[model samples]
Every structure is written in C-alpha cells, then in structure tokens.
Target: MTTNLLTRTHPRDDAAPVPPVRPHRRRRSLGSRIEPYLMISPTVLLILGLMVVPIVIVIGYSLMDNTITNPTPKFVGIANYLTVLGSPAFWGAAANTLLFTVVSVVAHMVIGVLFALMLNSKTMAKVPRAIFRAIYILPWIFTASVVAVLWRLLLDPSGVINYLLESLGLIHEAVPWLGLPQTALIAVTVINIWSGYPFFMISLLAGLQGIPSDLYEAARVDGAGPIRQFVSVTLPGLKPILYSMALLDLLWTTQQFTLIWATTGGGPLGSTEMLSTYTYKLAFNSYQFSLASTSAVLVLAASLVVAVFYVRRQRKEERR
Candidate 1:
C-alpha cells in the first residue's frame, strides 16, 4: 500500500499542464503568415504599377485615337489594329522581323551548342577553357547600343572588317554591309547572332554540365561514335534547356531594337525594319500613337503565345 501511494501521481501532477495561451499563439501564427505577405507586398505593388499598369494603359490607348497634340481622345475601337494589319509597310516590317528572328535563333543555337561542347570537353585545359568561355561571353557584356555603334563603325566602307576583307583579297570593292538592302538584313542578323549567342552558350553549357557522364560512358560502351552519342544521349538530355533557350531567344530577337536602330535605323529601303522599329517609328517619328499601341499589343500577343507554348512544353518535359 505504501509503494502504490509513492508511485501514484497526485490528481494535479506538477501543477496543471499549461495549455498554450490560445489567443497569444493564434496571434503569433497569424503574424508569421502576415509577415511573408508584408515582405512581398512592395514587389507586388511595383510590378502592378510599372508593368501591369503600363500594359493596361497601352491596351486602352489601342482603342483610342489619342495624340499628344490633341486634347480629346476619339474612340476608334479596333480601327488602329486593322490599319496596322492592312498596311504594306507593317507587313514588310513583320517579314523582316520574322526573317531576323528565325535566322538569328538558328545561328545562335548552332553556335551556342558548338561552343558549349568545346568548352565542356574533358580534353580542354582549364586555363584555355576559362579564357575562351570569357571571350565568348565578352560581346554580351557590352550594351546593345554600344555594340551597334561599334559595329556600325566596323562595317563602314573604310572600316576594319571591310579593310580586312579587302586586304585578304576576298573582295575587290569595299562592301557596304549596312547600306545595301540585301546585305543590310544579313549584317544585322550577323550582329544579332554575335551579341545573342553568349546567352545561349551560358545556358547550354550549364545544361551540358548537369548531364551525367555515365550516360556518355554507356553510349561509348555500346560502340557509339561521337556523332551518334551526341545525337542519342547529349541532345536528348539537353532538349528541355534547348527548348527553353530557343523560346527566350526568339522573343528577345523579336524585340531587338537598339542594334538595328543605332546601326541602320531600319533603313536601306526599310529592308531591316523589324516590328519593334516599325512601332518606334510610328509612335515617335510618325506621331501615330494609336498605331504604335496596336503594334505593341500585337507584340504582346505574340509573346504571350510563345510563353504559352513554352509552358506547355515544360509540362510535357516534366512528365517525361
């Protein structure tokens, strides 16, 4: 009986086990939840104010014939959109943009992959690899405006490139790269490729690095040649990254303005006039704000479509 009494706990053991103060705990939990929202609110507001609000204003303006000179804005209700769609100049600009974007992206992918493979090679010494990698990305470090201006100088009749070509006996006459309509598009494309490939190189190299060596080893063990192995193993592994880079590069190339502007200003008979250039000309040069707004909306829509495709592709890749 004494042992049982010693072992038995009192009716209230060690004072009542404290129930957490419900109100104070609830308040603390609420505060924790609210803190995250508070931290993000500023960024949310900035995006809404800067990006979303501007886009909304552009859309609204697309429906109105608004001008800086005019005090009143007349509602046109899709007239501006139709005008952009029907105009031959707009069509020409669209074609130019399409060609520029497609060719530039293709070149970027090919060159980016080649550079990535070279840099990622096990045979490459670290110092040389690092130096070459830095060189590849050097052009991208410069602003587009600076690059455009520099290239404009280099492509002039007596400029470095033409001089080099002449010195090499490749051409008898100094070819004006940005002056001829035929060469103007090609020159700008080359410039875009040079400036843009670095982005692809960085992304593709990172993707290549993420791939497992075991896969390559297995391919080799199966008697696969380098080309076959690359086609079979490397390409498949890098597919998702390639897709993502392709979409982003396409969009970026579509929006290219500075280089074309600073170099040729979409000139040589409007042969290099991209949609971005066209929009700029309409808004500022032609003082056609409504038309520019319509063009801007078209660009936005195109971007949105590409983004949707990218999202769907990502989902598919994730499943795979």
Candidate 2:
C-alpha cells in the first residue's frame, strides 16, 4: 500500500492554486467613478429645467407669433422684437425700470452701510444688539406681497399716513399717493428700498464683522477721523462684498414684480410701469405673449450685459 501511494500522482502538490473571480471589484471601481456625477445630477437637472428651459422657451416665443387667442404659434422671426423695441409703452417701462433700479440700489447702499456701521458699534449692550438685529432683519422676513399690501393700506388717501400728516398740519387734506402719476413711481421705489435694503444690510454687516479690529485702531493712530477711517479702512475692506451685493441687488430690483404689482398694477396711466410689470401686462392682461417674450429676452440681454461688466470689473480688481 505504501509503494502504491508513493507511485500515485499527487495532483494537489504539483498544481498551482487558482485565485477566485471577484465580480464586485469592477462594480466598486465603476461606482467610485460615477459617485460624484450621481451626487450632482439632481442639481444639474434642476438648473436645466428651471433656468435653461425657460430661457429657451422665451427665445422661441419671441420669434413666434404666440398668444392665447392664437392657439397655433407661427414663426415671425424678428418681427416681435422689432415691435417691442418700437413700442412707446415698452420704452417707458424700460426707463422706469432703469431709474428704479439705480435709485433703489443707491438708497440700499447708503442705508445698508449706515445700519451695518451702527450694528458694529462697540457701545451697544448685548440685549440691544440682539433686538436691533432682529428688528433690522424683520423686513426681509415679510414677503413682497405682504409688504406691498401693508404699504398700500398705509398710503391710502384716508389711511394712517394722511391722518398723521393732517394731524401734524403737514397737509391740510389727504394726499392721493398712488392716484397721482408723479408720486406712484416714487412711492413704489421707496417701498422697494424699504423692503430690499435689509439684504444689503445683512451683506454689509457680514463684511463689517470680517474686518480686523486692528485696522480701525491703526487708522485712528494715523490721525484718521470717523469719516476718514470709513473712507480708507471700511470702504476698502468692503469693496468685494459691496460689488457683489450691489450687482445682485441691481438685478433683483430691476426684476421686482409682486410689490409693484400689488401696489399699483402699473396704474395711474402706467406711471409706475416697469419692465417686469409691463411684461406681465403684455402676457396675461393684453394676451400678447410674443411681445411679452420679446420683452423678457431684452431684459435677459440687459442683465447679461450687467453680468459681463461685473465679470470684467472683477478681473480688473483681481489684476490690481
């Protein structure tokens, strides 16, 4: 038996060990490669749907004779664009929108910076600081619709504004704030400033907080007063934040809708008409979707111009 076992071929001893196949190895490599894309897919799809899709639709509509009355959209090329550009109403709205954006941005910058400075002051107690912060940001908490409605009630002829004015002998009679064409645009612009200033204020406050306290001390040591210190240290430090905030705020103010709509509906003979409100009027009220789309395209183009200018400015600043 021993001789037979020795002569028999020992397969196990002579053969090499085989490695088992690992199916999951390839799967793991693939998962690692695709994981980042999978994570960002939702955001990409959302942006495509929300921003790109609407822009494409607007462009398409601007080129077509599209309206509610006309179920079938016929391609009209640049006719709609030409018509919109030639329309007096369109030009008027554009002018108003431009003026409103400029005025509102300026007001926001001034008021916001002041508020931010006051908030950053060292004299305020902790409780008062907290309270002031809450109060200052309160406007931002309210929706544009709510703000518009509230302000409308206040500005009504028989409302608290006129009542107080009469009581103080400021005006012998109730003033027609919204009814007068002269005051309508200004009124809406003021409301826009009031509601929107908080955004700038918050941004400026953040910028202020990030500034090193030592810079102020150094400025003071160099015989700088409050104005000089602000001009040199504060403004320089806030430059980037200010630029970003102002550009974005300009875009938002120009596109503002709900507040102006709820207050005046571009009323008093379209005195308060803006690009945003005018677009709304053209679309739903007038059922001129093609012209509305044209307006939208123009506004988008203008906004792009602003964005390009901002990009250029930022590049120059960076180079400096």
Candidate 3:
C-alpha cells in the first residue's frame, strides 16, 4: 500500500490550470475613474453656461466703450473703470450701499439672535413658541417684490402706519416715508431688517439646538447665572454660526436690488441709490452699458471677497 501511494501523483502536486486574464479590467478601471466626473458634468456645464459665460461677457464689455449699443465697440481699456471710479454719483451710491448693508446686517443679527433665544428658552411652552415662530418667520416667507409692495403701502402718507402715528400724536401730520430723502433710507433699511431677520433667527435657532446639553449643565454646576451661562456657554457655542451667517448676510445685503428697486426706485434725489440701482441707471437710463458692466464687475469682486472669507471659515470649522 505504501509503495502504491508513493507512485501515485497527489492532486496538490499537479500543475494548476492558469485562469484567463480579464480583457475588460482596464476599461472597468477607466470607467470607475471617470464615473464621478460624468455624474457632475451636467452641473458643471450648467454653471459655465449660465454664470461663467455671462460674467466673462460682462467683464469683456467692461473693457470696451459703447458696447452693446455700438456695432463696432472701441476697446477703452481701464477708461470705463476710471470713469466710474471718478464719478460722484458712483461714490454716493457706494456710500448709501455701505450704510444700507451695515445697518441691515447689524439689525438682522441682533433681532435674529434675540428671537432665537426667546424661541429656545426652556420656560416657554411649545404651542406659544410655535405661534411666535410662525409670526416671526412670516416676513421671510414673502417674496422681495411682495415685501416691497407691502412696505410701500404701509409707508404711504395715508397708510396705516402714518394714521397710527398721527393718532398717537407722535406726528401732527401724515409723513411720506418713502418720498422724502431724510427718511427714505431709514425706512428702506427698516423694511430690509424686517424681511431679513427671520432667516438669521432660523439659522441661529438650529445652531442653538446643536449646542451640547452637557455644556450647559457644567455651566450651571459651576454656579453660573443665566446671564453668565449665556455669556460663556451660549455665545461661544453660537459663535461659528453667527460668523458664517454675518458674512453671508453681508454678501446678500450688498447685492440687494429687488426690494430697493421696487420700494423707492432709488428716488427722491438718489437717496436710496445702491450699486445695483446705479448700474441699472447706467445701462438702461444713461445707455452706458460698458460703465454698468464695470460697476457689475466691481460688485462681483466685492461679493467674491466676502465669499472667500466665508469659505475659509467653513474650512476652519470642518478641520476643527
């Protein structure tokens, strides 16, 4: 038996059959590598077509004179930019934009944070909280055009607001809130504040909820009063959200056009004229398309600056 086993070849000792190589391995790998890009290609193309192309064309037009209106536009180099920069109207519009943006953003933050705090309070019942939230958020639900029209009616000389003020003896006569240069900017800023605060409130409320309960407990155990706890714990937890929201608000407020356009029409001697209104007047009213394009580019540059800060902040938060 031993002699027979030694003579027989074991299956393990036999030469194994070689499997055939997969011809499609390289193709499969290549497809795998390209799949993500193919999936994103539509979005990329859409952005390029819609955003990138328009921006490039605007930039190009900014460098030329009498663009769009003239068949053969002359290349004016930096002359258009220089002209826009040198204009007092542009400077005035810029100053108004700055005031509008700064005031709106600050008010939005204060009101939003305060409302968020009220909604997030533990003593508040859910039903009342919900009711107040709905009321507070109503402004944000209205479209810009709707908001503009609504405010215009309310601020009219014979409207409800003036009637109330007159009845309260705050003013002897009805005031045209949107008509006079003195109060036009203030009225629009207030309107913008009302429309914008709800977004901040919603965002900050979400941020408040994300704060760890343990942190609050620790603060309480340390004998921190409500004010102290808020100062140390609540504010710290909300800092990141506040920073991001503020930057985003800056960008949006800077580019605000629709509300300003519909409300005051940058009127009453250009009291409420913004960069947007200024650009619109340049292009359509003055027929200075090239100059308007330059202004548009300048606005884009400012927006980009804010966007860069926001992106960097997001990256820092992600890393942390």
Candidate 4:
C-alpha cells in the first residue's frame, strides 16, 4: 500500500516542467509606427505641394467663372457645369473620346494577347524572342511628338505608303488619310493601337509565363484541343491581367491629346475632337478657362465612372 501510494503521488519527477511563453511585443501606436511615412516624407510632400494643391485650385476655379481675359473671378455655383452639359460640343467630344477608348482598348487586348501567345511559344529561341520583344516596344519608347510627326508624314497624300499603294494599283488616287473625318479617326486609332499594344503585350506575357505548363498538359491529356484548352485554362488564368490592362487602356486612350492635337487639331469638322483636346482649345484658343475647367471635371467624372464599374465587376468576379 505504501509503495502504491508513493508511486501514484510522486510520478514523473524526471520529466521537464513547461516553461511560460513570453508575450509577443506589443504593436506600436499609429504615430509611433509611422517611420515608413517619415522615410518617404519628401515624395509625400512633393505630391501634396505640386499635384494635390493644383488639383484643389482647379476644383475651385472649376466652380467659378474665371476666364483667361477676366481679371476678376466670381463664384457662379454650378453654372459652368450647366454650360458644359448644355453644349453640343461637349457631347460630341465625349462621344468621340468614348469611341476611341473602346476601339483602341479592344484592339490592344486582341493584338497584345496574340503577340504574347506567340512570344510565349517554346519553339522560339531566346535570342529571337528577345529581339522581337525589343522591336515591339520600340514604338512605345518613341516620344509622342515623334510618333505624331511620323504618322503625319505617313498619312500625307504623296507619302511612302500612298506611293506604294498607288504603284501597286491598290488605289486609283492617293487618299488624304488625315484630311477626311472617317480616315482621320481611323488613322489616330491605329497609331494609338500600335503605340499602346506593346505595354499590354509585355504585361500579359509575364502573366502567361507565370501559369504552370502542367495546366495545359493536363488539359491536353483530357482530350482538349487548342481552342478548348485556351477557353478552359488560358482565359480563366488571364482574367486579372485582362481586367487591369483594359481599365488602364480605357483611361489612357480617353485622355489622349498630344497625338490628336499634333495630327488633326480636332479638325475635319470637329470629328476628331476629344475631351482633352476640346478642353485645350477652349482654354487656350477660345480663352474660356472656366469652361475648360468644367470640361476637365467632366472628363474626371467619366474616368471615375469607368474605374468604379471596373472595381465592382472585379469584386463580382471574385465572389463568383
């Protein structure tokens, strides 16, 4: 009985005792944890000083009647906005801007995806692929002014393209590509597509290369053809990249002005007029700074709408 009681009462004396764990270091307060912000203080200050302050001033000016010739500014409430909304020119510009954005973005995505797929092929050597990639990006690296001038030359009646086409009996006469409204729009859209697709191609190629080869192999093993494999595997994998690139392209193409201004100057009876170019003409040529500001605000609103829709769609996709 004594042995039994001793064994039960004093069991496992050689076993180690559990040590108490020290509590994790407490997180610093919001202000105390702001060292990163301090490190980037110069950039933050520069943005606020340059960008944010000017935007705020523009917002104020947009709310008032302040023209280029007017020395005195007056707060006219939403009158500027009303004027912009009532103007047929504003609607025309907005329509052109939207049309350009849609067409260019669609073309960019289609062409970019195709080019990326080609580059991603295993049959291409690394050297040739690199050379092709560099060549594709060369157009994007050119200054906008240079591209505009180059296209202007190309679109001229007796330019190399027209000469070649006429010599080949492809046309009866040299077409004034930028002089006519229809051709002008087409020329600008094509130039934008050519200049913009490289960025999308590079981004999409990276995304495609990240996708595991096993997915494609598995699809093939399951008796999937090329089209079927692309539909089932590639499309779903590239969803995020597509969404991001489309939104970026939409925003950029809608605001394009340099190429338009340098090429058409919103000419051919205002057919090529976009919001950005329209705003510039109003502020500078017509000396209507207030109206220009209002136009700019409208552009900002449209961009915000596009962005909001994209974000909502992305969230819906995520939920699904």
Which candidate ranks first by TM-score, i.e. highest?
Answer: 3
**lDDT for each residue of candidate 1 in 24-112, tens digit (9 for 90 to 100):** 88999999999999999999999999999999999998999865556898888989999899999999999999999999999999999
lDDT of 2 by residue, 97-139 (tens): 9899999999999999999999889899889998999999998
**Cα lDDT for residue 53, model 2?**
96
Clashes of 1: 0
Q: Which candidate number would show the highest lDDT if scored against the true structure?
A: 3
Off by over 4 Å in 3: 1-19
Per-prediction count of colliding residue pairs?
Answer: 0, 0, 0, 0
Better of 3 and 4 by lDDT: 3
Clashing pairs in 2: none
Native-vs-model 2 lDDT? Answer: 0.91
Q: Write the per-residue lDDT of candidate 4 for residues 269-309, one digit (tens) a residue.
A: 99899999999998999888888888887788788988997
Model 3 whole-model lDDT (C-alpha atoms):
0.95
Q: Where does the lowest 10-residue lDDT sum fall in candidate 1?
A: 7-16
Check candidate 1 and list the clashing pairs: none
Report how far off residue 97 is in candidate 4 (Å): 0.7
> Candidate 4: where are CA atoms >4 Å away?
1-34, 309-320
Each prediction's TM-score versus the true structure: 0.90, 0.89, 0.93, 0.85
Question: lDDT for each of the candidates?
Answer: 0.92, 0.91, 0.95, 0.88
Model 2, runs deviating above 4 Å: 1-23, 309-320
lDDT, candidate 2, at 86? 96
